[model samples]
Target: MRGGEAATLEAVLQSVEDPEIPVVSVVELGIVRGLDAGQVTITPTYTGCPATAVIEANIREALDQAGFEDIQIKTVLSPAWSTDDITDAGRQKLKAYGIAPPPKGAKAASLCNKSVAECPHCGSINTREISRFGSTPCKALWQCNSCHEPFDRFKCH
Candidate 1:
């Protein structure tokens, strides 16, 4: 691809929104791993997530519509995706969407330790997990004691 084509492709790919979370794009969610001359690499957030196929399909359709039909979408499973890969802007967006973003660093260990998650609505640390699973497989249901509001929290992985 020419330099201009590559730049355009990058921009287009960056703008592709996540199907499950419209507020965040695939790039912001850290799914778009790399962009090359005619290839776009991605790593799904969850292994068995139903949204994985949707994400790939959306990217494919976007690329095709952008006149980059020759570009290939590759899924990279190695270096498995972690919540830490989510960009700062993505975390902010998630919070603004009323979903608590995962804490940075030691994701697996922190979750195992039952780290307190701040309430997305009231910013209270006094929250409890209502369910291990939330509306999505990647999130957990939580309720804020202060505001008595229920929210979904992106699970640390």
Candidate 2:
């Protein structure tokens, strides 16, 4: 790879949207952790994420289409993935997509804790978790008492 090739690859990867959340690119979701010469590193939101294979496949397709077939993808589970890995812009995009972004800095120990989740639609803090699991495994179903609207809350971990 020549100078700036890796950066170009990173930018290309930025165009690959998450399979579940199309509004946010995988890059914005913090899945593309590193971009080095001839390689891109990624960490799925969860280990058993059903979309993991899809995400990788999408990335592979994108790379091929972008003339980056020479680039390889590396999946890493160490250091783990966290809601905190989500970029600030990603959080904003999630809210705009009608899903409550998780509170930052949350860990597994606080999984049962009911932190106030602002309703994405009406921006109301008055919300309740209807179910620990939402439309997907990585989110929780929540309803806003004020807006009477149901939305998904991206689970933190």
Candidate 3:
């Protein structure tokens, strides 16, 4: 492909948003692991994620629009995905969008009693979880005591 064409694909990838979390782009979320030869390989943030199909569709649409007709989309599961891989900009975007981003390695250690569920609304640790399932499959439902508002917490992977 020509130089401009490759740039077009990059631009298109930046536009593909995570279907489940509307605020973060799949690229910034570190899901698009690599791009080469009209092919884009991605690993889902979470396995069996409900938004996998939509995310793939978005990637395909973006590539096609960028003139990549022979696009190949692959999903890699080994090595898994972690919240730590998410870009700092993506995390900031999530916060500004009113959704709390997963803390660094907090979700993994959360199972050991080191809960990192801080209230996004109040920035206070005084919060309670209402449900594991939030508006999206990737987030948990939580309520803040300080703000008295319910919000979604991005689960650590």
- Superposed by TM-score, candidate 1 places the C-alpha of residue 3 at a distance from the truth, in angstroms, of 3.6
Candidate 1 residue lDDT tens string, 30-115: 99999985799999888889999999999999999999889999999988888888999999999999999998884657554267
Put down candidate 3 lDDT per residue, 14-51, tens digits, no spaces: 89898867788998898988888767889987677778
TM-score (C-alpha) between model 1 and the true structure: 0.93
Among all windows of 10 consecutive residues in model 3, the one with the lowest summed lDDT is 106-115
Candidate 3, residue 85: how far the Cα is off, in Å: 2.1
lDDT of 1 at 46: 82
Better of 2 and 3 by lDDT: 2
Best-performing candidate as measured by lDDT:
1
Q: Please give the distance, in angstroms, between residue 101's alpha carbon in candidate 2 and its true position after superposition.
A: 0.4
**lDDT-best of 1 and 2:** 1
Question: How well does each candidate superpose onto the true structure, as a TM-score?
Answer: 0.93, 0.94, 0.86
Residue pairs that clash (backbone atoms under 3 angstroms), model 1: none
Better of 1 and 3 by TM-score: 1
**For every candidate structure, what is the RMSD over all alpha carbons to the true structure, in angstroms?**
1.5, 1.5, 2.3
Give the residue spans of candidate 1 off by over 4 A: 108-110
